[model samples]
Target: MSADEGARHPEDITVPDAVSAPDAEGRPRRVTRRFPLFTRDTARPEGSGRAAPLDAPAPARQWPILAVLSLVGIGLLLTALDVFRYGTLLIGVALLGGAVLRWLLPGVGMLAVRSRFTDIATYGVLGLAIALLAMMAQPDPWLEIPFLKDTLHFTVSG
Candidate 1:
């Protein structure tokens, strides 16, 4: 046999496991496992290419993610400075902006997390939820639900 014939490919050669299954009838069998796409490959999300030209700086290349992160950082800072309602609203707005950028822009850098639809759904839903919660926060809520208090009281006190 030629040297190429003596050298078997990894996938072509399979050794059996120590233990045998009832279905194997005591014969040795090759054990192989399949991996999902994420494990096998790390393809970028759709429209996740650089937002700016290659000649631009790194920050420019990834400005979309930077913008969202900066807004979130500012929101946290505002929250620490005792501006809870507006701070939370700003954070929600940041997420909404990410969703919008992902939707409208052809290349959003790292802002595109998953597929276009999935990223939009995730960001939009989280942003809406946070914004609604901020509007309904305690002490003097802007959008109070009349039945929510009753429901909470019933669940807690009943």
Candidate 2:
């Protein structure tokens, strides 16, 4: 609203004293300020920083994610080339590696997708599940569970 309009309507939300007060940053502090629907400023997730110095090349600065992505790409190629089990295992290992990087490194660039704990948990759980499933897949499974076999038989038989 215009200053004249606010002056006319004293009952409006124009807290003259509070709005004029300077904050630590010297910006006007609004006492009755509500959160904006969309924030203009956002804090980066923890560990989301360049792996290399600012002067380094883009690839070097973002090497952590690049490494993970490269592994995943190779895994996809292997899967396409008919090495199903190994390819899936490789992909899972890549995710697990990403989790390890996030945990150990102080900065991981784009590898830091979310909060450290959440990212680690997500990557670890998904990686382990994929690897375990790959190990148990198809004819002559590597890690067999008799109970699972029975349950599968029962469900299909029914």
Candidate 3:
């Protein structure tokens, strides 16, 4: 083989027939190719899906979730305002309420941020933890959680 032919990669060898013909203006009209990320089946259908685009107005059915989240926000606001006692209690209640809502109404519109199982597990665990911690808070703890006082002492000391 000639040196030129030997040096050329297989992919570099283009078929003459596949080359674009010259256009009326004498410019080589190349064919442009497009590869879409999603095919017809993979593409999201309009007006049908679990979640809508962020710009769209929220559905009316999501009010319950909004209310629950509002309560949680209020609780956090109270905590920020230095009312630790009532604030913490409210926060716990909100989290527990969220979990209950998730359980009872799986199709709770936008409130179903994640899978039903995940939402329930997260809300329940966090709510219970907060409630427990609030009950065991210092200065004048309200509820006596068995062995928690000793556990906290041990963890804190060592």
TM-score per candidate, chains pooled: 0.73, 0.77, 0.58
Q: What is residue 49's positional error in candidate 2, in angstroms?
A: 0.7
CA lDDT, candidate 1, residue 54: 93
On TM-score, the candidate that comes out on top is: 2
lDDT of 1 at 58: 97
Query: Candidate 1: minimum summed lDDT over ten consecutive residues — where?
Result: 31-40
> What is the C-alpha lDDT profile of model 1 across 1-158, one tens digit per residue?
89998976656644454243545476545434634223335888999999999999999999999999999899889999999999998999999999999999999998988999999999999998988899999888999888998999999999
lDDT of 2 by residue, 18-92 (tens): 445788999876555554344458878899999999999999999999999999899899999999889989999
Reference-based lDDT, residue 148, model 2 = 88
Instruction: Give the Å error, residue 62, model 2.
Output: 0.7
Model 2 residue runs over 4 Å out of place are 1-34
Task: Provide the lDDT at 46 for model 3.
Answer: 27
- Which stretches in model 3 have alpha-carbon errors above 4 Å? 1-59, 155-158
lDDT tens per residue, model 3, 23-62: 9998768753543333335432221233334565775546
The window of 10 residues in a row where model 2 has the poorest summed lDDT is 9-18
Ranking by TM-score: 2, 1, 3
Clash count of each predicted structure: 0, 0, 0
* Structural RMSD, model 2: 6.2
